[model samples]
Target: MQAEPCDQEEPPSVLWGLDPIFSAHARLYVRDILQMKESCQVPGIYFYRFHPIFTVDVLGTVVYRRERDDFFCYGVDDGTGVINCLCWKDEQWKQQNEHVKSAPRSLASSHGGFNPVEQLKKLQQAQRSRSQLEIGDVLRVRGPVQTSVQGQREIMASTYYKVEDPVMAVQISWMLELPQLYRKFYDRCFQMQESDLTDSAQSAPALLGRASGLLKDFLREKAVERFRPYDLLQKLVPLIPDIPPEPSTQQEPTPQSSSKQLHQLLRETLQLLQDEGLVFRKVISQDPVYQVTELDKELHRVTRDIIREDSKREKYAEKGCHVLHVLSAVRQRYCPNVSKVVIEVVLKILECNSEIISTTDSHYIVL
Candidate 1:
């Protein structure tokens, strides 16, 4: 029987490198890795379904070995297939091993007491011995996939070490994890929503308006009170307009260009939302997370109450309550981590809802 053709369209090559999965080391069978498709646009990059992979982690037994001056090449067989792994030697460790071997035997007791430097040298020699592999020994290797001069696919190992799994526990764990990874991430097709494609021809303001509306709808539907940028980025990626290639050059967009466009759109949309009193960040952080203003009902109530009660105070009631006074009161009554920006947003929201009115630019009173 023949396999059915996939209906999903492949995402643009420029977006391939933006995916976090491409940065991680994929755990795949040697046979599958060898058979995977290589990207014509970016050589040395392989794809397993929609997943772009360059590095892989493999656990197998060494079936063959060849020594070089600076590196050792081993044929690793994980039962499915055999692939060559080029493991580089550590020059410092090699030198330490040589020094220990050449040292005089009488040096062991020459001090007639405990010698810390000599003991450290002995430890380094033992580590060097463990790293050296023989045929039939279990080995684990991780590195980027590359094509050798002979046109054979191999791994240029960044890390390689001998495994001592006497009872095969490590192998069994790896066997179980591979299938889960494939089912969850590797096997799935990268697809964009049809609705997003339909809006691709829309203007920039229209696109931002639609994205903001979608985010509002999502928060309402999901009842998300607080969220990080990543939680909403995936939902907005499809809305990013595809820029047409120049007719003169017909050059494809680079990964950096596409990624920058996506982030730029998201940043503009988020800033718009903040200006409209729809969302605010509670704390300044390298990784900023936002809170949906309308979703936090308790904050709105507490903010309104602070203005209502403080407005009636007799400290020359002509000006009502200052923004700073409300901020201090809200911090004590509500969450202490709330920022001045959050209070400003909340005050704007309450004012818009007719729950309060601004007595001055920096003061508010309950209506």
Candidate 2:
């Protein structure tokens, strides 16, 4: 007898071994992910800008619901839209959540629920132990973009994290991401000549050379602890003997011969000094002020006293003493004359040199 062909078919094999240049997933809003289109050439994968490696991140709230013994689903809404995410059970996850899954399912009854109070407590406790998350908690998810045969989109999550500040998280996400987008869009939109861009960069360095010496002399005057740009400009212009005189006639003035032009030059010079670590700028009441970075000179003169006081107290062996202790000791013994700003700058330099260590939110430690 002739054999009939079997109707049963094997499951489709996934492309599991496709490696990417960057293992790091891209941070994307839920709207961006949902809007992606499938690549014409690749099956079961989504693409953005025609690139197949479209892994992404989404931060949102998820509502938890138990789907099976080995699975659960979360309906995540990230302001833009909602997505149904499926989290599969790994061996470790299954082991950790065994107690919750092993609970009797007979407790779920049709009429008046059986053991509803007891079941609710067990589920809540299980959720805490398993995901350490509750329904409606804001979370950050990282995963590959997946599109099913029926046009439904989803993310196969690789990592999940609880977000503490959603606003800060969104702001930080755009802060990091917008630069790349700006470059892509602006470069295409305004195609400037390479020579023009290069010339613009070179002009600033030339200005820096002319103004560097004058800036050093102005700072040396010690007229104030810090100077706002306008106040500093008032005192600084006279010191620059080479500053071009204002145009006398109605004739158009050369670029080098205007005080208005010098305004921009002075601003760029201060920025250069800041970049070179020769000065520090801080904003006060919406205005930025510049301070010379010369605390090391004073610190060098009193280094012996600092070490001696630290040794007497055995502070070197423990977490370092606070800046206040060293400041107080230095003033009492050697230099009775010093500013608080000078002392703080010296401590900051020591921290940078690894002579001491300070945590993001804590006191310094001796190293």
- Residue 355's C-alpha lDDT in candidate 1? 89
Off by over 4 Å in 2: 1-23, 63-66, 93-132, 166-367
Each model's lDDT: 0.77, 0.54
Tell me the lDDT of model 1 at 210. 54
Residue 307 of model 2: what lDDT? 49
> What would the TM-scores of all predictions be?
0.48, 0.33
Q: Which stretch of 10 consecutive residues in model 1 shows the poorest summed lDDT?
A: 3-12
Instruction: Give the TM-score comparing model 2 with the true structure, all chains together.
Output: 0.33
**Candidate 2 lDDT over residue span 36-72, tens digit each:** 6554445545543222345676767776644666555
Per-model RMSD to reference: 21.0, 21.7
Give the least accurate 10-residue stretch of model 2, judged by summed lDDT.
7-16
Per-residue CA lDDT of model 1 for 1-367, tens digit only, reads 8954432323345656555678898899898888877766577887775567889999999999999999999999987789999999888976676777787777657778766458977788677766789999999999999988897989999998898999999998987787678656664434334444433224464456556666766776798999888788777766644543331355765467767877777888788777755787767689998878877888899999888887778971778788888889988998666667778878867875688887666888888
lDDT of 1 at 183: 53
Over all chains combined, what TM-score does candidate 1 have? 0.48
